[model samples]
Target: MTKQIFKPRGQNTTRAIAANVFSLCFPLFLVDAVRRVHPVALQQFHLLPPDGADLAPGLLEDDPRIVIASAWIDLTDGPVVLHLPHTHGRHFDLTLIDTAGEPFASLGTRTDNDDGVDVAVVGPRWSGEVPHTHLARRAPSDACWAVSRIHAHSPLDRPEAEAVSRNQHVSSLGRRAEHRTDHVTSLEPPAVSSLRQVIELGPAVFFHRLDSVLDRAPIGFERSVRPLIDQFRRDLDGPPPVSSWSPDLAEALELGFADGLAAIRAATAAISESRGIGWHAVAVPQHDESGASLAQAGRAYSSLGAPAREELLTLVCEHDGHGRPLRGDRSSRLRFPPDGLPPVRGFWRLHTRPTASGDKRHGIGDRNDLSPDDDGALSLIIHDLPPAPGDLGNWLSAPHGEMCLIMRLYAPRGEALSGAWRMPPIEIVDLDVDGSRPGGASSESLKPNRRTPS
Candidate 1:
């Protein structure tokens, strides 16, 4: 008996279109994973920091006072242990994220009370006996991402912060623990620069990398989006495009890619809404299936945004509490009473940025410009000019055009992280009539609902 085989050209074209769309969104999760494991840049379980002279080139923005301890782990070999140092009186946080960049566990002053621990991370397929002293956390994929934030109050704080950073250790389950101090490796600038470029590859090449990533990733990770991943792997894993190809198939793939990009933009926009006080807080921890797929794409294209929730809760304020744009044209004051300061064990600092893209402008808390009253309450002035006589030591200079304020509470107390405590508002102050004495602006004017100082 002989069987005849037939091809449905229209059906094949339709499937190809659908596969292209899935391929576009797949990168959102894969890009970060690929970047972390790229042999040219990162090594498994190697600890690296964003030293003053060495910033992750592709990152969108970074703070000068914070040093990041980053490492990428592959549990395929065995469980990897993360050993944190005892940071006395210092605030340090280490966050562990799964392949999807969702933080599943954390360690720090806020989360661990400065007492360090040795935790073991294993892959989903691992079956082994972890030591009783080791806290075992299973990762969703074979690869895990960890970023630790060590607070450096100033240039002087670097040495001590560096010490804490060096104390971090990672050991494969059965091997002797390896401290980061045991080896010295400099940042790979050229490889880091290529991160952004690789993410922008053409569809065919991009999907090829995506397939390689999915192959190594946890199969359960794709279960939710199984159809999408399967179809893409089947239809789009073939050769490059050519003019000789079917016109309808070519057009369909192009349209699918365009539609995928549009879907990602819209998805990111919807969830990117600022949660009052000009902050874009992450309200959703584990994203819905569709959202998770698209948001990863949005963040990948935008540069190194937040890789994970690394114990750092940041709030960006483009407008004052009174609904005025944060601008250099007008002056503003952020006052923190000795009794009502940010509930943090680490510390809190407010810095200004010219626009979202500009470097951070030096400010009060950073430079010791904060001025404290008799009651020890610190009040900082935000303006374009030099410090005024009455200005507290905390003088945050506003940007020339529209500005934004990032109030970062490192090692934040539970109250701050749980939304139980609210950051004080930025009060827009009217500059003195002569514009000579910024000191003339009284702290009393900022006392809410009453003329007298609180």
Candidate 2:
């Protein structure tokens, strides 16, 4: 005779139900974000080169070193092929992202050579044979995104970057090829401004969009979680119980979304203090402490819900090391001690921007005319004053009001990726100190050569 195993329901069952609800909805959150911007299509590419005065393509935190080629992709009908042109030793990457904004595959200098590659991106259900000469990658979801970045060292490099971008192409199996478009347009809606607006989306509106995307894309979630997804569908489709009102189910839906947002915030907050001094470093574990490993939700939330770690490693500072808000009222020094520079094959940059409004201030880094001191230490002085005689190579413009400083390391070294190295502290310099300056006069009268940190 066969025996059946059963366990009694525990007090944590409701909480488990709530957590499962969050995982189901998390991936759809980003999918809805894309829909809020553009109408659904098989493929569309934005081919404009970044002018440093405008936003890049799909996301925020753009840099001047790389020009972006972005597109929203759909592979429900057949396989999609991304055609990468030969970059001739320039650094570039074509990152393939899933519905949840987690990178599933990469084609670039790090993975493939700069000679360029033609990659055939297939969906989970695709079984047809791909060409032998082309690289083959299976995407987890039918709906995905591709961001292609080409290195542009300076204003003079824009022409070459544009030529390389113009040659790249994208096509589906047995279809006419689609090229990049030149016009610039805004696809993102104005209503979705901040993170709070995303979290505050009501359940019915949010889930309705989520359910629609799941209908088209098969993300191939783990087998254990499939039942919970089915339950969510049933809860939405089936009628409310005889004793319950329709509004009650809506309340539960809102509660689940709130719970998911809270969980994400808590996970990010737990790791916020690991970076020392006044900087916030970005990091995430490949697996949890239990060794069970993390799936899409954990990876998606790791960089505070960014696409991937390979995209960029960032350090943010709202205040100086001395706990003063970063402003032009007082000068600040960002000193790189001996052997403290970022280890990367690509490059590093530092710039400033306001948290609430206005464009980012003028940036500076190794890409510019920066040079080390006699002891091989690199120092950058930030203020609104004109560049002094000796300060021509190290002066960075800081907006006169409150602002933030960001350090971005492109193609960071393994040490940075593994969290083995930390950035040095940014020292605050007081211009009014005695004996520190040549004449010890007020900050307004001080020349660049006369200013020194205490």
Candidate 3:
């Protein structure tokens, strides 16, 4: 017997199963590799008024008025330029922040006669950090107009060498300060700076990887990728606060390579946990034209479009407790409801901040400013000021025109999403002169109410 020859029966079956799995998941791996290598490269530079430039005084630690100009980037091998004007006759600080609102770098300069400073940044390459140059104004001017030009170059190309030569030209712009602010009125430069040569490879890679992952991943896994990508972009291109670290090239390089990765990871976690259910609705009361009590308002308006129909208002019933919707409170701006709102064993709050145009600003407002009713229900009024004494609990100030409401529900029970836990509908009610509802007409009888200054 020539060494009994035998073949395994299940070998082919095992191989086939493995091949199928690999075929489904190979694209995701390729995409992930690309995404990891092609990170978002951003450079945002802007000028800000000095500490005491405004007559009303500088912004406090929490005020949103301190920002002047900002920019963002999401890819490498490109150049970005900003021409910042110095109109207030004061020296301005030029600052740059990555997407995480972390400071990247800064260049301080003085200007007179309105001639601003010029800043140029080069993205990283295979070599060490790319060299950047800053040219200080030759002479002082009343108002400085700074021009920024950013460039992105391919690592494969002679990016480092070319950047050096291009930087020389950028440096030359500061050689003479005699030119007036109107000297270069043309918004379009004759040629784009070399830094702009780099391409935004991160966005392309991110999408490609996302497509691959979705093909083989569970719905939750697939859904989480977007927030991660968004966070990556944001960390790479948002504004830093004033108290942040001073902007320097070394700091930016470190943040770009390190903190950027951290942001991506955090975003991935958030996306993974998100259930993908966007908005849900709860039941409330409906009213008739004569202000008579009618039927109950159900979940139909949950997805309805705004400027809501007459006799109907849809309040966001479920949200992460961050803030409540209120009308006249200024301190409630820039708050996010606590994450995940539902009817549970926790407390809830809601508030609203009036936009300049009377709409709600994105992602602002939380529970700290809302007043609760006698029965423990949260009340909100959309008027511009505190309602008369009795109605204070429900009065929220509305801008003169259109407005939005933000509500927060905290520690909501797990049953909230399934409708097992129900919250009373947010009713729109009319306030009498003394701020109390007359005749108890209910929320439906509330006419178009006004609470702002005459």
Instruction: List the candidate numbers ranked by TM-score, top first.
Output: 2, 1, 3
Model 2 weakest 10-residue run by lDDT: 285-294
lDDT of 2 by residue, 1-454 (tens): 1111111146433334444555544544544454345445535555533431122113454455466666677787789887788887777777777665556776587665468777888987789888897899888777677767787656577678767766666688656475654532323333443243455666545544555755644344433344456664564453233245365555555565666666665655565554434888655322121111124444444432232466567777877776767786467778777788887767778887742222233477776788675677777777665446556577776667777788877778899877787676666666656335222322333335444433
Give the Cα lDDT of each candidate. Answer: 0.56, 0.59, 0.29
Residue 436's lDDT in candidate 2? 50
lDDT of candidate model 3 versus the reference: 0.29
Compared with the true structure, what per-residue lDDT tens digits does model 3 show for residues 1-454?
0110111135232222222222222223322322222222323222222221111111101112223332233223333333344323222344332211112344432122223444543332212322244332211111111222221122232233222212211121223223232222212111322111111223223333434444432232234333433443353342233244354522443333233233333333342223222223423211111110101111111110011111111234222223233233221122112332344332343433343434222222232354333444443445454444554434444454334444434223446534454433333333333344323324332334335534
How many angstroms is residue 126 displaced in model 2 relative to the true structure, after the best TM-score fit?
Answer: 2.8
Q: Where does candidate 3 stray beyond 4 Å?
A: 1-347, 352-378, 400-404, 430-454
Better of 2 and 3 by TM-score: 2
Tens digits of per-residue lDDT for model 1, 1-454: 1111112266555544543444444443443533444353333334344531222322333465555666777777778888777776566776665655455676667666367777889888889899998778887777766767676766577677777777776778867554547563433534443333443444555555665566544434566454555654466545345534476656666565555556655655655546456455432233233323555545443323243333555666778886777786567777666676777655567777753232234344433545465666666667665344444245565566787787766656778767777667777765443333233445443322212212
By TM-score, the best candidate is 2
Candidate achieving higher lDDT, 2 or 3: 2
